[model samples]
Target: MIEVEVEAGAWTAALPDAEAVAARAAKAALGTVEGDVVVLLSDDAAVRALNARFRDKDRPTNVLSFPAPENAFPHLGDIVLAHGVCAEEAQVQGKTLADHLSHLVVHGVLHLLGRDHEDDAEAEEMEAEERDILAGLGVADPYAAEREGRA
Candidate 1:
């Protein structure tokens, strides 16, 4: 079973159906991996700080994932999301905020499962997995939107 702990830090509005989204994303990404994951929803400033600290990037990102060590038992690490960025991306992509958020959650979960898209080939694989998972959740292909200049 997959477990999720949600932390709403510096977010203005409450996330609607956050638990369900997290659960779905976890299941889609890890399949039957028994573990606990933490999801944090925060404002742009917090996410930006985290990005700067962890990734050495100064800009705020939509989502960031930090995976636990291999020795850790039933713990998949954490996913941090910037609510403001997500909303803005959704607006720019012409998709609902919830859909964008769902996509990001799934993407982060995939990262926790040791998935990376740093290279073209790896990106293709990761995007394929994201497409399949998002499709199961009734979300359109996020990469397609990007390719069409809609995201």
Candidate 2:
């Protein structure tokens, strides 16, 4: 199950079908994984607070993932998205807000699935997976822009 909670009005205004988009992206990421995921659509303030309190980062990011404990079955984790940062990033990256949002959801879900990009090898592997997942969603390769120096 994927539950989407909209905590910010901007998300709705920016993407009225945000919840459906999130669900589709998350499901594409999960594939055969079995569990429940909660998605929080919030503002920069909420995300910044969470980032500071949990990650020790004082700034807001596009998305953050919190995985469930090892023994937590039927409950995978939570994915939070900051509308302001996401919108800004989408604009900067020359992508529609929906596409960028889907990509972030896929990235966050991968984190919940134990994928990390702390090293070159790991980052490459994760990016490959993201590209595959996003491609399945009809979203172009997100890193392609960076590779071509467009972003």
What's model 1's lDDT at 72?
Answer: 81
Candidate whose TM-score is highest: 2
Instruction: Estimate the lDDT of model 1.
Output: 0.81
Model 2 scores worst on lDDT over the 10 consecutive residues at 142-151
- What TM-score do all the candidates reach, one by one? 0.87, 0.97
Candidate 2: clashing pairs of residues: none
Tens-place lDDT per residue, model 1, 32-105, is 67788887777788889999998899999999999999788688788888878888888898988777878998
Highest lDDT: give the candidate number. Answer: 2
lDDT of 2 by residue, 1-151 (tens): 9999999999999999999999999999999999999999999999999999999999999999999997897899999999999999999989999999999999999999999999989999999999999999999999996877844
Candidates' C-alpha lDDT: 0.81, 0.96
